[model samples]
Target: MFLLQVDEEIQIKLLMPKDATALTTVLCANQEHLKTWLPWAVEIPSVSTYEKEIIPSWLQKFADNNGFEAGIFYKNKLVGMAGLHYIDWRNKTTELGY
Candidate 1:
């Protein structure tokens, strides 16, 4: 999977199915705050949802060379998620989202 080290305390990587529980926990904990800016955060998803659907979809996007959704980890803990929504190959550009 893709992995990047930003600094000593932070890293970014493609999330896998095994990370579902941690991802779900973090998302649910931040649901209210996230809902303020993210419409989809209005409803929190369970770990099973993430494991069976969301993570696989993200992995597929990466495999397709479109773009990818990744987890932001701090001290080995999942803190958030970010992504390059889609890449415009012809334009050599992509949009970022978190």
Candidate 2:
């Protein structure tokens, strides 16, 4: 849940409709910043893939208490995105990937 950069006056919160625009902007701006570890990276126009693909998957997982996704916000704007992935509640541990 603690995704903010150290010493940064910002916070990470659940992705909301209001964050869609900023999130899209950052994703585009930082495409290179992400491609190293993110395999699904693509040169997409608009935010449809994120809205149509990423969010849906994250929402379902989060709802089932199997994941937690959030936008990294700096000064009230989304600076990046991160999440907890591959959660295994039964094992008393969740792989924290953010």
lDDT of each: 0.94, 0.70
TM-score (C-alpha, index-matched) for candidate 2: 0.73
lDDT of 1 by residue, 1-98 (tens): 89999999999999999999998889888888999998889998889999999999999999999999999999999988899999999999999998
Best by lDDT: 1
Clashes in model 2: which pairs?
Answer: none
What is the lDDT, from 0 to 100, of the residue 98 in candidate 1?
A: 83
What shift in Å separates residue 95 of candidate 1 from its native position after superposition?
1.4
* Model 1: residues with Cα > 4 Å off, grouped in runs: none
Residue 25 displacement in candidate 1 (angstroms): 0.7
Q: Looking at model 1, report the run of 10 residues with the lowest lDDT sum.
A: 23-32
Off by over 4 Å in 2: 1-8
The per-residue C-alpha lDDT of model 2 at residue 40 equals 53
